[model samples]
Target: MRWFWKWYLWSEDWKVEGSFPYHLKKMVIIVAPHTHWKDFILGVAVRSAYRFTYVKFLGKQELFKPPFGFIFRWLGGTPVDRRNNNNLVEAVVQKFNDSESLVIALSPEGTRKKVEKLRTGFYHIARQAGVPIMMVGFDFKNHKVIFDEPFMTTENEAADFERITNFYRPIEGKIPEQGLMHF
Candidate 1:
């Protein structure tokens, strides 16, 4: 599978930047410019190419049902009930605390549509879990997946967000118009 994705990415003219930080056991991976469904495919392919089997991603609970449920699970999908007041951050923090090694990826935009601002859940989760946040840019225009260095959160949210915004602002998504255009 890893070789297949390596070949596929090359065949598709896509490039992955930055190496995986294998030293870290637990961290939140924040993927930006998630403006199309194909982003998931690219993410999975990159994960395979890197042989990063510890990675997991949250998805709506509905996606965990029916014919494709097993496939999602096999691809490292963890079902999340977004509708419930589940104290998701705390739950994830507990998961981090209990596990010796885990890496979960999340999209700050939380959707493929254009948003006024990003959802700060990933940051909060990283802060609460006492883990660093790794930023990954899915730049469709450049055909590159750029990974930034792992960042530890400070007391100031605005400053942190400003830094994140600046890092992701230049990356264009598959649907360019729906990409992160603002902080």
Candidate 2:
């Protein structure tokens, strides 16, 4: 496992920014500018390089079918019923409470399609769980993965979001767009 991670997983140009603090036992990690399906592949490479062991993420419940579902579960995926009106943040918080070291990664962009605003679920989940947010960025310019300063949400949600978004702003050109631009 470590052999593949050290050699084949990460690209030579890859770099990480902020350190994953030891104090943070449970938290939310957000992957941004989710413009392509390829981002998912890059995520695995990044995780393997960092030797990140505490990652788990959500996918649509439909993906929880047959052989692929088993593979997804083994790879740390949780099935989410997107139609449910119940707050996902509360559910994520409960998961944090249940595990000693839970690290959930979410794409703020939510979909491959472009959007005017990033989803706020990552913030809400971290805030509710009383854990810091680890902001990870994949810059296509040099094909590098940058890890920003992991932060804990305070009273100001808007400001905190801006701070997080600013890091990705410079490399926003790498963001791919779907045909539907008006939305």
Candidate 3:
């Protein structure tokens, strides 16, 4: 599968930048400029290309049903119920505490549409889990998947979010207009 994805990325003229930190077995990975479904495909390909087998991503609970459910699970998808009053951050923090190693990826925008500000769940999750946040930029315009140095969350949310916004300012998504509009 890794080789297949490598070939696919090559054929599609896509390339991954930077390296995945192997020392930290557990961390939060946040991908930005998620304006299209193709972002998911690119994410899976990049993970395989980087040989990151422990990476898991959350999908809507609805996606966990039907015949395709098994496929999503095989792809490291974890069912997330977004409708209820679930304490997702605490639950995920508990999961991190229970497991020796776990890398969960989430989109701060929380949707494939333009947003004025990013959701802060990923930041809180990293802080609560005592793990660093891996920021990944999917720059479709450059056909590059860029990875930034892992960042440790601070108590000041405004400043931390400013840093995140600055890092992702240059990256262009598939639907540039529908990408993040502001911090």
Candidate 4:
């Protein structure tokens, strides 16, 4: 699988940027500009290429149903019921506390459609779990999977979001119209 991903990434001309922080025992990774489903496949290839078996990703409850659910689970995906009134952050935080070493990657945009601003769940989850936040950008325009250095959350959320925005601003998603438009 790792060799396959290495070939796939090379065949697709995708370049992974930055040194992955492999030493972190736990982290909340945020992947930005998720404007298409292909991002998930790209993520899988990259994960395999990097041998990131400890990292887990969340998928909608719908994706976790039927015969396909098992496949997702096998790929380290957890079913997330993102419906109203669910204490999702608390639940995710608990997963961190329960695990000795875990890395959960979440999409800050939370949807495939265009969003005015990022959803704050990823930030709050990292803050509450006492884990560092690692930002990853899928730059479709440049065909790059860029990883940022992990940093712990701070008290000022607005500032943190500003920093996140700046990091993803230049990266184009699969569907440029549905992703965060650059200012």
Candidate 5:
């Protein structure tokens, strides 16, 4: 499967930038410029190409039901009950604490729609779990997956957010207009 995905992405002319920080046993990966549904496919492609199948993600409960439910699970998705007022951050942190090593990738936009700000869940997850936050930019314009250096969250969230937003401001999403254009 890794070979297949590598060939698939290579055939598509997609490239990855930066080095994967394998030394970090746990991390909260924020894949941004998530302006289209196809971003998920690219993510899986990169994950498979790198043979990083241990990386997991959370999806709505609805996606884990019926005929297609098993597919998400096969892709390392954990169903999340979005309708309920679940303390998701703490739960995810608990998962990280319980496990010796765990890596979860989440979209900062939280949806395919355009947004004024990046979601803080990833930040909180990384901070509370004592894990670094790794930024993955799906630059559709450049046809590459750019990985930024991993950094641990600090006491200054506003300044950290400013740095995060600036890092993504120039990247182009599949839908340029719907990408993170502003902080």
Candidate 6:
């Protein structure tokens, strides 16, 4: 069942650089142009393929329900009650500190819709954790998954997002709804 889903849902086009560097033992991965929900499956599939067994990610607290919650939790979903406290950065940083080799995955878009300003949580988390930030490109344009160079947040949201977006400019197949948020 897992193999079937992976074959159908995940991208067939992939380019790996190398094993997650040992120096980057602890890091945050930023997934950009998060214009569609399908990226979740692709992300999980890639993680499994690379044997990246331990990953942590944020999701709305509401999604943590019953059977679905069990599956999500098994796959590293950490529920966040953003409405009560919007300080996900601090919470995620704490999680990093709790784990030996944690890798938190974040979607800068923050949703499956267009947004003018990218969320800055990933930047702050990476900085607070004192770890490198790696880029995971969904490559909707070319139907691929790419692992690019790692970076460290410079606390410059606008410029940093631009640099990250440009790195994915070559990718195609971005959904039309993502147009408004295009860089």
Task: Itemize residue pairs with steric clashes in candidate 6.
Answer: 140-172, 141-172, 141-173
- List per-prediction Cα lDDT, in the order shown: 0.90, 0.73, 0.89, 0.90, 0.90, 0.71
Question: Residue 116 error for model 2, in Å?
Answer: 1.3
Please provide TM-scores, in order, for all candidate models, with all chains considered together: 0.96, 0.85, 0.95, 0.97, 0.96, 0.81
Native-to-model Cα distance after best TM-score fit, residue 174 in candidate 5, in Å = 0.6
Please give, for residues 1-183, the per-residue lDDT of candidate 1 as tens digits: 899999989999998888779899999999989999999999999999888877999887888999889998988898888778788888999999999998999889888889989988889999998899999999999899998999999999899999899999999999989998655
| Structure candidate 5, residue pairs in collision | none
- In order of TM-score, best first, we have 4, 1, 5, 3, 2, 6
C-alpha displacement of 21 in model 6, angstroms?
A: 3.9
lDDT of 2 by residue, 1-183 (tens): 556655654445556556655466787888876777767767776676677755887766777899678977877888777677677778888988888888888787777777788778778888888899888777766566777778889899878977876876655425545312222
**lDDT value for model 6:** 0.71
Predicted candidate 6 versus true structure: per-residue lDDT over 116-166, tens digit per residue:
766778788888988888877776655667777788778676787778777
Candidate 5: RMSD to truth: 1.1
Each prediction's RMSD to truth: 1.0, 3.1, 1.2, 1.0, 1.1, 3.0
- Residue lDDT tens for model 5, 11-71: 9999999978888899999998998888989999999898788899887788899899999
- The model with the greater TM-score, 1 or 6, is 1
- Stretches off by above 4 angstroms in model 6 are 1-23, 155-158, 179-181
lDDT of 6 at 172: 45
Please, what are the lDDT tens digits per residue for candidate 4 over residues 20-76?
A: 899998999999789999999899999999988779998788888988999999888
Q: Which residue pairs collide, candidate 4?
A: none
